[model samples]
Target: MNTSIVGTGVAVPPNVVTNQDLVKIMDTTDEWIRSRTGVRSRRFVDAGTGTSELAAEAALAALADAKLDALSVDAVVCATMTPDRQTPGIAGALAHLVGLSNAVVFDVRQQCAGFLFALDIADMLIATERAATVLVVGAEVHAGYLPWGDAWEIVLGQSTREPSAEERAVATRYRAWSVLFGDGAGAMVLQRGAVHDTAASSGILGSVLHTDGAHANLIEVPGLGSLQRPYADAAQISAGLQHPTMNGSALYRMAVECMPEAVRQVVAKVGLGLADLDLVVAHQANDRILEGVRKRLDVDDAIVPSNIGNWGNTTAATLPILYHELCQTGRVEAGSLVAFTCFGAGAHWGALLYREP
Candidate 1:
C-alpha cells in the first residue's frame, strides 16, 4: 500500500509582525532583516493560545479539504518543539479538539524538520495497514522562546508605552535567532492506496532521512529540557539562557549541503533524476539556504518556491502551508513530480518524493 496525501491546510495567527514592528521592540531594520533572511513579515499567536489550538484548526481545515469527518481519522501524528505541556504533549489535545476520539495519537519533536518526520510516521502506519487514514501536523508557538521580558505588552499590542532601554537591549541580544521564527500550524490527510496506478496515481513514493548529531550545538536552547536538573529557573530565564542561540553560518552551510544531497539520493532511489521533479517544496529556513540548494542542484529558480518572506520560518509548518497554497493556486497538478525537503535544529534533515494524484 502507498500513503497518499489527500488534502492540506494551514493556520497562522492574525498578528502580522513586520520587520518594522520588530524595530519597535528590538534593534533591527526592515532592510537588515530582509537582506539576511528574506523575511519582511511574520505571524504571532495571541497571548493565551498554544500550539495545540493552532494544530487543531489546521487539522479541521485539512479534514474539510479531504471531505472527511473527524471520525475518519485513524491516527494523529504531530511534530512540534513547543508543546502546551511537557507531560501530555500536543497530539492528544489536538485529537481531542478535532473530535478524533478513536485515533491513536502521538507527537514528534524535530524542530523545523518536524512535519517531514511526522509525515514519515503517518506513512509508515498506512503502509503497514495498521491504519487506513492518518492526520499529520506540524505546529509551533515560538513567542514564549523569545526574549520578550518586560516588552510583552508592547509586542502583543496590549499597551501603548514604548519599551524601556533595558528591554530593547535584551531583545536585541536574542533577535539574531528569535526573529527568524513565527508561530503557525500546517496539516495533511493521508490514506492508504495502491502503490501507483498507471493513470491517476499520487502519493509518497520514497524518502531519505539523515541526522548528524555531531553538530547539534550549532543551534542550542541551553535550558528548559530534561538534561537540566531543573527544567527551567528564574536565573536561567533572567540571564537569557532560555532563548535559543544559533551559529547561522554553520547552519547555512549544513542546510545547503544536506538538503540537495538528500533530494538527489531519494530521487535516485526512486529511479528518477533531479530533472524529473517538477517542484521542490523545501523548508523555509532562509533565502540563502534555499538559493544554495538551487545553485547546487542547478535548477531554475521557479522550480523552488518559497513563502519565507511572508511567513518567516514557521518551523514544521512551512511545507504544508506552502504546499497548500500551491495546490490552491493550481500550481501543483496531477502527475507532477514533487520533492519535499527540510533541515532543522536537531541537525535533522531529509527529502521525500511524491506525485500529484
Candidate 2:
C-alpha cells in the first residue's frame, strides 16, 4: 500500500510580532534580524492556550480539506516538543478537541524534525493495514517557553561586572533564537492506497531519518527532562535553565551538513537525484542553513522555497505550514516531485520524498 497525502492545513496565532515590535523588548534591530535569519515577524499564542488547541484547529481544517469528518479518521499522530500537559500527549488532547473519540492517538518529539517523524509513523500504520486513514499534525506553542528577552533584561539590570565570556555567549545565542522562533500548527490527512497504480501520480516515495545524540546538547531545555528533574525549583526557573538553550554555531554547522545528506539519501532511495526534485521544502530554521544546503546540492534558489521571513521557524509545524501555503498558491501540482527535510534538537535530522497529489 502507498501512503498519500489527501489534504493539508495550517493555523497560526493571530498575534503577529514583527521585528520592529521585538526591538522594543529585545536588544535587536529589525535590519539585523532580517539580515541574519530572514525573519520579519512571527505569531504568538495568547496566554492559556497551548499546542493542543493549535493542533486541533489544524487537524479540523485538514479533515475539512480532505472532505472527511473527524469521526472517520482512524488514527492521529501529533509531533511536537511542546505538549499541552505532557502526560496524555498532544495527540490525545487534539483527538479529544476534534471529537476523534475512537482514533488511536500518540505523540512524537523530534523538535523541528518532528513533522516528518510523525508522517513516517502514520505511513507505517496505513501501510500495515492498521489504519485506512490517519491525521498527522505538527503543532507548537514556542512563545511560552521562549522568554529570552525577559531573561536578558533581568541579567542586564542585575549585572555588576561586565558579563564574562560565557555569559555573553549565552545572551547572544538566546537573543538570536528568540528572534527566530514563532508558534503555529500544520496538519495533513493521509490515506492508504495501491502502491503501484500507474494512474496514481502522487504518494509518499521514501524517507531517510538520522539522529546523533552525542551532540544533543547543541539545542535543549537543560532542566526539564527526567535526567534533570524537579524542574519547578525556583532556582532553576530563575536561572532560566528551564528554557531552551543552544550552541548556535555548532548547530548551524551540523544542520547544513546533515540535512542535505539526508535529502540525497532519500532521493537516491527512490532512484532520483537532486536535479530531479521540483520543489524542496526545508524546515524554516534560518536563511543561512537553507542556503547552505541548497548550495551544497548545487540547486537554484527557486528550488527551495522558504517563508521564514514571514513566519519564524515554527519548529514541528514548519514543513506542513509551508506545504499548505504552496498548495494555496497553486505551486504544488500532480506529478511534481517534492522533497522535505529538517534538522532539529536531539540532533535529529530527516528527509522525505513524494509526488504532489
Candidate 3:
C-alpha cells in the first residue's frame, strides 16, 4: 500500500510583529535584521495558550481539507520541541482535542527534523496497513520563554515585551536569533490510497532521512537538560534555558555542507535531478542556508520558499506548513516533483523526493 498526503493545514497567531516594531524596543534596526535574515515580521501567540491549542487548530484544518472526520484518523503524531509539559507529550493532548478517541498517539522530538521524521513513520505505517489515516502536527509555543530584559532584547526581539536600557545592550549582542524566529503550527493528514483517488490527487513517492549526532553540540540550548541545570542563576532565568538557542555560524556551515548531499542522494535514488523538481521545500532555518544549498546543488531560483518574509522558523512545522501554503495557492499540481529537506539541532538531517501524483 502506498501512503500519501491527503491534506495539509497550518495556523499562525494573528499577532504580526514587524521589524519596525522590533526596532523600537531593541537596539537593532529593520535594515540590520532584514539584511541578516530574510524575516520582516513574526507571529506571537497570545498569553495562556500552548502548543496543543495550535496543533488542534491546524489538525482540524487538515482534517477539513482531507474531507474526512477527525474520528477516522487511526493515529496522531505530534512533532514539537515545546510541549505543554515535559512529559505525556503533545500528541495525546492533540488527539483528545481532535476527538480521535481510539487513535494511537505519540510525539517525535528530533527538533526541526521532527516533522520529516514523523511523515516517514506515517508513510511506513500506512504502507504496512497499520493505519488507514494518520494526522501529523508540528506545533511550538516559543513566546512563553522570551527573555524580557533589555540586555537580551538587543539580540532578541522586543515585540514580545517592552525592554529596559540594560536589556537593550544585551539585545544588541544577541540580535541575530531574536529577529529570526516566529511561532506557528502545521498539520497534514496521510491516508493509505492512490493519489488520484484522493481529494489532493497526489501522494508521496520516496523519502530519505539521515542524522549525525557527533555535532549535536554545535547548535543547542546550553542549559536545563539532563546534563546541565542552570536554573539556580538569575541570569539563566532571564535567558530562558528551555527556549530555542543556536550557534548561528556553526549551524549554517553544517547545514550548507550536509543538506545538498542529502538532496542529491534522495533525488538520485528517485532517478531525478534538480532540474526535474518543480519545488524545493527545505527547512525554514535561514534564507542564507537555503540559498547556500541552492547554489551548491545548482538548483534554479524558481524554487519556492514558504518562510514568509519574517515568520522566522517553526522547526518541524516548516516543511508541512510550506507544503500547505503551496497547496492552498495551487502552486503545486498533480505530477509535480517536490523535494523536501530538513537539518536541525539534533545535528540531524534528511531529505525526501516525491511526485505529487
RMSD of each: 1.6, 4.6, 3.3
Report the lDDT tens digits of candidate 2 across residue range 52-127: 9999999999999999988899999889998887576787778889999879998998999999999988888987
Q: Summarize candidate 1's per-residue lDDT along 268-332 as a digit string, tens digits.
A: 99888999989999999898888998999999988999889999999989999999999998889
Assess candidate 2 and give its lDDT: 0.85
Q: Write model 3 residue lDDT over 231-263, tens digit each, in one string.
A: 356666556655556678989898887878888
Could you say which candidate leads in lDDT?
A: 1
The lDDT per prediction is: 0.88, 0.85, 0.79
Runs in model 2 deviating more than 4 A are 148-173, 194-201
For all candidates, what are the clash counts?
0, 0, 13
The model with the greater lDDT, 1 or 3, is: 1
Ranking by TM-score: 1, 2, 3
Greater TM-score among 1 and 2 belongs to 1
